[model samples]
Target chain A: MIEALQFEFMRNAVFAGLLASILCGIIGSFVVVNRLIFLAGGIAHAAYGGIGIAFFFGIPYIYGTIGVSLAAAFIMTAVTIKAKNRQDTFIGVLWAVGMAMGVILIDLTPGYHVDLMSYLFGSILAVPSADIRWMAGLGAVTLVLTILFYRDILAISYDAEFARLRGVPVNLLYFIYIALVAVSIVFIIRVVGLILVIALMTIPPYIAEKYVRSLMMMMVLSVLLSVVFNMTGLWVSYHMDLTSGATIIMVAATGFFISLGVDQVISFSRKRKTQRSSRKMLKTKKDAL
Target chain B: MTQVSPVIQVQDVSFSYNREPTLTNLTFEVPEREFLAIIGPNGGGKSTLIKLILGLLEPNHGRILVKGRSPRKMSKIFGYVPQDVNVNIQFPIAVMDVILMGRLRHRGHFGINKQDRQRVMELMTMTGIPGLENRKIRDLSAGQRERVFIARALAADPDILILDEPTASVDTAGKTELYALLKDLNETKTIIVVSHDLMIVSSYVKSVACVNQGIHYHPKNEITETMLQMGYHCPVELIAHGQPHRILKTHGDF
Candidate 1:
């Protein structure tokens, strides 16, 4: 693992993983806490439409994907706000339509032979320096904005109505937050691809949520957890020649299961201890008699 | 003769959802330092009136003025305590963090200010939930959670404090204690509570507004038979502990 960092591609992979972790740690915390996992999944899959649009129009991938992804995100946000009862159905439709559109657009592109598997399974080892720079820039912007509006975001995530009554501009902030989520989803697609992007955004935060008592702590811990999973998955997949994106998701899933098991064990032991104490007290009462 | 404007004035405000009118031509006024209760049956537009006052929804026909301005623009002056926190119980947040979020105005960039922290602690002390500041919000009991939310609402120091069904989940004793707290808070902050809890409305509130599709403001605690019949389809009968049973008339038919 130490020697692997010498290669430029490996260095880029590690750097890209770090950038992805930062974005996931910060934005993912908001996503998981606010229960926006499905919305995010919709955005990630819909981002495929952006990629397809880029290839079809012979433009850069970032431009087309970001543009279309943001548009889709705005549409989803509007639907979620206006017709909340039917948002799930609409998001499901958008998710499928985005994927179908991406496939159809790619097929329609002339003289283009793009490796669809790479986009689906991710090619972290093949990440270019330019993309890494883009990831860094996006991550920085997200971090600054998140910190600047941390209180408002926290208020909105917990209870949007209360946030509005407190002068938090809930609607405007919600639009901006969803837009940022869309942008982050696009950059993360380069690291883990679109299919596994939701996992990367949610798994670590879900785990961190169990242990931490504040959003900030949860985000920081989630970042560390994400880094660990990304590095370990990258290393394991590198040695075994497995798909990096799938491996990272598997690692996160294993961690999630382990945490759940550990939580159960802790609670079960505590309950047993209480029961034992009560039984001992009963025995002592009988002994006194 | 010039006079101080009421803290909240809803002048013939009408609202609808999906073109189905919920509140029609409702008019009310909440004066300064007053503890008022807005009570009605389910779907009687009680919650809608509160939402309109908070500017979460706009009135279609008439206007609502909070401190002589629009309700939406008066957010800083209105502290709101929703019926339920409506937060996921498993959300990882401390009691203090929940209270500090109320101080989310234009303070500093990163952390809460010293004055804000002091104010939060003061509110915690006042609400009698000081020691539980570090506890997880989910760990607190229902009553304790209500107190924490009250402390959070008061942390903003708003002139008007609005609560929606505050005692919905609280026990009888907790409800009494909460009423006492609100009665004390009314000394400084104007309180507007939306509830269906008739018992408390009879006990604590200085004024009552019976809202169905419209509002009938009663400037005193007495619940008149006419007000009850107008607000609810049937007049509520008080038949407990040897209390006189007032025969209810439904839609003008016995």
Candidate 2:
């Protein structure tokens, strides 16, 4: 197990997992806060259209998926913003349409013999150095952009109308957020594939949310938790000879439940302590009387 | 008392959604540091007028100016609190974190610094919720939640504060406390509140703008049945001391 780190594929997988964890944790904080989990899921699954387009047009998958996913994300953002009350219905419809389009287009690609499971369940063991580089570049860009627009994003995510009143360019920020999610989703798909991407993007942050006091803190904790989950899951998959994506999701789920249990136990102990203290005070008062 | 320039000016502004008119030929002005209450029935376009002034919705005709400039240009000068604060409480955000959001325009794209934290603390203190700075927003009561939003608005230190039904969901005591807080704030800034509770507005506001489709301005003490009828398009009775209020007959159309 310790010797696995020397292998090139293992090194690439570990690097990619760590990088992907940071990106997912940061963006997932926003996605969970803004209730964009469904939208992010939609965007992720929708990137398959880009994959199909790439196969058909014989272009690189990354370029095709990024471009197509960005366009879809923009459209989703526009529709949701413009028609505020009716956003869910529109997003749901788009989600289905995007998935259907991808499946159909992929079927039409001439003489294409690509393994679908690799794209669906992920192939972390097959991660190449080039993909790691792409993930690193995208991760760095996301970090810089998030740090720069931290305030605006925080404002909009919490209260959009208030942000608009403060002279923040709400619409522009909205579009930028969706675009960032698009980029994040593209890389996230590379790690967990479109099928399990939502869990990877949401679960760690969801668990981290309970303990953090600020959004930045939540992001930090989430990234750390995500890395732990991803790395451990990767290690488990290597030893057990199981699927990498499923293993990561299982680890995240375990973390979420453990956090919940810890919270419950802490609350219960606090309650018991308070009750004990109150009884002691009562006994002391009775003796004094 | 020295009078400052009007912070908000509306002239012949008309708005509609889906070709259905909501506000028609509405005109009003909110002088600087003036506490104005806009009261009307449901679907009477009070919120619409507020939105138009806030530049959330564009009017089909006429103009609105904030700080002597268009709403588009003077966005930063205004702070708004909407009626419904029903946010997903499960959302992972802290109280001070929410208040710090109001400093976005000042901070621009970068994250909040030490000064931002100090300002948020100050606003929380001003709103009398200093203890809530570290609390999760979802754990707060309705009144506390309202104060958090108020603190967020005050964080910007804007020239104007616009609130839609700020006291609607809170208890009676909370309503009284909130109105008193607003009254104190109005001494230094313009406040435009949209509310249906006329008694509270009459007690706290300096002036009132009654709107159904258009707007009719009146001094707080001088509000009458005729004016209420005209503005609300319904019969109104000023029940003195709650001794079975009598409904005044509706006036004839002009």
Candidate 3:
């Protein structure tokens, strides 16, 4: 792995993965706690429509993708808030429609041949220096904004109505947070692709949440956990010559199952110990009687 | 002449959702340090009135004023404890963090100082949940969770504390302890609780407001027969105050 890091593309991949991990760790914590994974996944899949528009219209991919995802995000947010019972149905519709639109538009684009499959499964080894710069820029923005509004975000995520009453600008913060989710979808798309984005965003945080006591710790631990998965996956995939995106997902899923198993074992032992203690206490009480 | 302004004033406030009126032509006042209770049937606009006072909703026709200022402008002076409908039970947050979120809107110069930590500790002790700050909120029982929320509400150090059905999920013993805590807090802060736990709350509140489409306020603890008919929109029995689960009047079937 160290020898491979001498290559420029390998270095870019590592940098890209690092940036993606940090962004996912922070944003993913909010996403998990706020239960916005489905909506976030919808935004990511819908972003493909933007990618298609970008290719067909001969525009920059970033602008087109972020624009469409943001629109999808705003619509999804409004629907979830207004028609909560039908939120899943609307998000599902948007997800499929976005994918379908992307496929159709990419098909119609004439002359310029592109490997569209790369956008789905991702080509982490092919991450250019420009994409790394974009990821760094977006990661910085995410970090600053999260630090500036950490308390407000925490308050709103816990109890929005209470936050509004306390004048935390709940609507403004909510919309801005969702918009960031849209932008961050573009970030994950660069490394893991839209198809596999939610796994990287959700699994680490879900595991971190069970171990941490605060949202801040959850974000930090989740980032560390994500970095470990990315590095391990990249190393394994490099050796075996496999797709890096799916490999990272496999690593994360493995970690997920291990955490679950460990949690079950801990609880099982706790129950057995409590039962033993109770039996001893009962015997003592009987002997005393 | 010198006069004391009301802590909260609602003058002919009306509100609706999608053209369906929930509250209409309501008028009321909550004075300083008063323990007030709001009661009504479900969908009778009790929660709506609380929202209006908290500035979460605007009156369609009239106006609401807090300390002679707009509720929105004086928002820093109000502390709210909501029904917590969307509280994610699996959310990974400690009791300390949950309470600290109450101070989010407070404009501290340095941010989260030792003073804030001290205040949180004092509130935890006062709320009877000390030594549990490091515990995860999900690890708490329903009763302990209620105390945690109450501590969070008090963390803001606001003059007016508002709660909506705070004891709904709490057990009978927890409910009594919650109301007793509110009564103790009312010595310094003005409290307005929108609750249906009438039997338990009546003994603690100094006044009562029955909200239907309209509002009828009695500036004393007693509930009149007429107020029950107006609030429930039907013939209803009043369970005697101070004696919970005891029906003061029941039909001949019993």
Best candidate (score: TM-score)? 1
**Which residue ranges in model 3 land beyond 4 Å of their true spot?**
A81-86, B1-4, B107-110, B169-177, B198-202, B233-254
Q: Could you tell which candidate, 1 or 2, scores higher by TM-score?
A: 1
**Per-residue C-alpha lDDT of model 1 across residues B1-254, encoded as one tens digit per residue:** 23445898889999999788999998778878878887777788888888888899888989999888998888778778878764578899999889987787733234578888888889988877878878999998877888888888888777888898887778888778778888888888899998766566667788777788877787776555667778654233344553233222245442
Expressed as tens digits, the lDDT of each residue in A113-192 for candidate 3 is: 56767787777899889888988988888889888878788878888876776677788889988988889888788788
Determine the TM-score of chain B of model 2: 0.86
The weakest ten consecutive residues by lDDT in model 3 chain B span B244-253
Candidate 1: segments with Cα more than 4 A from true spot: A281-289, B1-5, B106-111, B233-239, B242-254
Write one digit per residue (lDDT tens) for candidate 2, span B67-152: 77789777777777878776767766789888887777573544568898998988888777877788988888888888888888
> Using Cα atoms with residue i matched to residue i, what is each candidate's TM-score against the true structure?
0.93, 0.90, 0.92
* TM match of model 3 to true structure: 0.92
Q: Model 3, range B153-211, lDDT digits (tens) per residue? A: 88888899998888877887777787888888889999988877655444788877778
In model 1, residue pairs whose N, Cα or C atoms come closer than 3 Å (at least 3 residues apart or on different chains), thus clashing, are none
Docking band of candidate 3 = medium
DockQ of each: 0.67, 0.59, 0.66
Looking at model 2, residue A106 earns an lDDT score of: 80
lDDT of 3 at A1: 100
Q: Give all candidate RMSDs, comma-separated.
A: 3.2, 3.7, 3.5
What are the per-residue Cα lDDT tens digits for candidate 2 across A82-173?
78788777777777777787778788887875678988988888888888998899789879978887877777887777778777777887
